[model samples]
Target: MPEAVAVDPVCVAGVDGCKAGWVAVFRWVGSNRASEVQIFPHFADLLASEHEPRKIAVDMPIGLPQRIGSNGRGPEKAVRPLLGMRQSTVFSIPARAAIYCEDYREACSAALAHSTPPKKVSKQAFHIFPKIREIDQLMTPELETRVYEVHPEVAFWRLNGQEPIAIPKKVKGSSYPAGLDARRDLLVQFGFVANFLDQKPPKGAARDDLMDAAVNAVIAERLLNGDAEPFPTDFGRDERGLRMAIWA
Candidate 1:
């Protein structure tokens, strides 16, 4: 008999901070099923949770090239000469890759097609790239230290927004996809993902959990494919070690 290789377990988490609730789906790598569904009070809870993630894939921005709009000082100013005349989010390395990638484009397009208000859906999806950069720029070192240290809250806020952080109730439940049908389209992509994991295409409709799992799965795919890297510094080596990457 030949020896069998063991599949390493990878835990995947998907975070969606909706208008009235935040939903998270955690899945183990070896199986096609999610290990848990965590509905938290707010986005902070998702970040502060005691659970340790071996390989995290957050659907958020990780970094932004600093000095884009700095006071035309220091290294930022010098880099401009090297970067040429044009600099925008769309042209940034990460954004360019994310927007053009076949899977992400298809997934985003599918989301728009299903949405009732395609414009709004398209706007939000389109914002992810620049927002990642924006958040990284807007978040202060002091605030970052107080909350996440170097945890990449910038990316989190870019995807979920700071509103959820301020107004916890806005994103706290089951009826997350109530009136916004277009936004629901984003959820639909997740549904397709869950079905794919289950080895069955979506029959007719899928649950929000399935959709969340799908998003997590996409993040997982990106991390393995080297779309992102882990943050350099550790927040602290505690019972809950620092998250290496926002999307890893």
Candidate 2:
């Protein structure tokens, strides 16, 4: 008899930023089960971890532009109308120069200077600047071949047969149970087991964060199977030649 051999499971990840850090859900290839759930304080650390997922679908903006056009970084503009009411979840990312600024006011100033007819950074967009900057700093054309920019609402829109979710996952900054259940039901239809969907979120992550990450994992599986499509079919590139397109 041959000695037992260890085999590493082929996997992909869906990541969402949380209050504590990044919450990543690892799903095995060719299956719906999530093999692991983790929270990493830094994006780089997740990359360097042992899992080495074949693809990473993250709910963060990538491919920052040097100059902005009327509709934001192209991907956001392309996907917004598809999302209907859920479109608000996609924030308009400003120029790379603006994202590097240490202060919110400075970032707004940079955005105004770099955008056409001038635009100011929204407080909501400003809040996620840190996570955006984190991925931007590490992204390269080579790395981007595996890491993809994804928006949970956009993913959900795709999951829900191209229809925008009828409910908002959050209302007035509080999680809505009905909305969460609505999404969970959709995930179930798409092959996720109820046990995984109902599991308590790891520390530092909210229930919504975990769900968002889980949906991203679904997109990751799509990407791996070559079943996913990018918004703005033509896509865009940042100064460093990183591709900018939201995948679903």
Candidate 3:
């Protein structure tokens, strides 16, 4: 690993997990252009990279609870209804113990023990547990000030004048062109160039992944400017003091 170089105070990033690793889109604050789109095999590398942004809005869960309530966490509960049809994009995260488990059955068992009403971990949420753990292991209270948990659908809802987007980005595990186009249009309305939005995503990330990352970057800028708000007006913190709110 290389030493982290001088930070770009004006830069902010939007990141999402991808098949290869984490795909990040870096943009300068107040600029419409995305400076770069790249992938890191590990989350830690992005933190150590030369382009380390002042704020990062990533499409992943940041805070983990010791025990969960009805809707997973406060943030998920607050934002789910706001998404309407797109709410399915948000998954209810289980407890930290469940997330740390190595096997699906073990995770479900742990989740049942940790959550109220004894819910099992969903396969979709379980699939991303490793990525969640990756961020959890490296995250600290101070780091929480810079890295924020964001959901792309939630961000889009906020961007779309607080109305839920009617289109699903994917259907039956396949990309939907109309849905992608709708999101792209929203991105353009928010100052992203259509040219950059249409460019091929870097190897290992899908087009929707890139677009999700781009919207996250937009929210990062909003957060930097004090223009963004958390899902739960009053947020929660885990045992380690990591913030448990999703910003948009």
> lDDT for each of the candidates?
0.37, 0.90, 0.91
For model 2, residues 82-105, the per-residue Cα lDDT tens digits are 987788888888999999987999
TM of each candidate vs. truth? 0.34, 0.94, 0.94
Clashes of each: 9, 0, 0
Q: Which residue pairs clash in candidate 1? A: 19-170, 20-170, 20-172, 21-171, 21-172, 21-173, 61-155, 115-182, 190-211
lDDT of 1 by residue, 1-248 (tens): 99999887665555543333445556565566545656655555655666544434444433332112212212222222322222111122222223332455663554444333431124444544443433344444433322221111222222342211122111343324442232233334533343333332133223543443445544544454455333332311212222213332
Give the alpha carbon lDDT tens digit for every residue of 100-125 in model 3.
99899999999999999899989999
Highest lDDT: give the candidate number. Answer: 3
Residue-pair clashes, model 1: 9
| Positional deviation of residue 19's Cα in model 3 after best superposition, in angstroms | 0.6
Our tally of clashes for model 3 stands at 0
TM-score of 2: 0.94
Model 2's alpha-carbon lDDT is 0.90
Pitting candidate 1 against candidate 3, the one with the higher TM-score is 3
lDDT of 3 at 197: 77
